[model samples]
Target: MNSSRGVLELPPVVGRFVDGVGTFLADDVDEGRPIRCRFLWSAITPTSCRWEQAFSTYGGRGWETNWVMEFTRTGRDCTNNG
Candidate 1:
C-alpha cells in the first residue's frame, strides 16, 4: 500500500524480535472461516527491507505466502519539503 490508514483487523500485537526477524500474528476470518494471519518483516540492507503477509488455515502449523513486497529507498530526500 502506498498509503497509510487505520486497520483494526490487525491490532498492535508486538512480537519478540529474534534473529533480526520481526513478526506479528493475529486472528482473522475469511469467508466466515477462521484463519491465522502473519506479517513478517526483515531487513535486507540498511536502505532496503523485505515484507510478506501470509495466511495459515492449518491452525498455525503451515503458512502460505499471499503477498510480498520489497521496499528499497530511493535517492530522493524524503525528509525535504522542497
Candidate 2:
C-alpha cells in the first residue's frame, strides 16, 4: 500500500476505474468480492480528499454525481463454473 500525505492506498479489488473529464467512474462489478476501500485525509481538504479530485475533475456537484447504482447477478446469470 503506497500513500502520500493523506492519500489512501486501498487494496486492489476487481473493478474498473474509468477516467472521466474531471471525476473517475468506478464500476464495482465483482460481486464475489466488492471493492473494499479505506482512506486517509488531508488538513486542507478534511471532508474527502479523493472526493474533491473525483468531483472537481468529473464536473463538480451536479445531477451527474447524484447516485451510484449497483447491479447484482443471480445464479444462472453467472456462467463461470468455479
Candidate 2 lDDT, 1-82, residue by residue in tens? 2334666543333333334213333322223443323221223232222322111222323323323333334435345655
lDDT of 1 by residue, 1-82 (tens): 2134554455345565679888888887787788888888888688899999998999789999999999998878878854
| List of clashing residue pairs for candidate 1 | none
Alpha-carbon local distance difference test for all models: 0.81, 0.31
lDDT of 2 at 12: 39
Top lDDT: which candidate number?
Answer: 1
Q: Give the range where candidate 2 is weakest over 10 consecutive residues by summed lDDT.
A: 51-60
C-alpha TM-score for every candidate: 0.77, 0.18
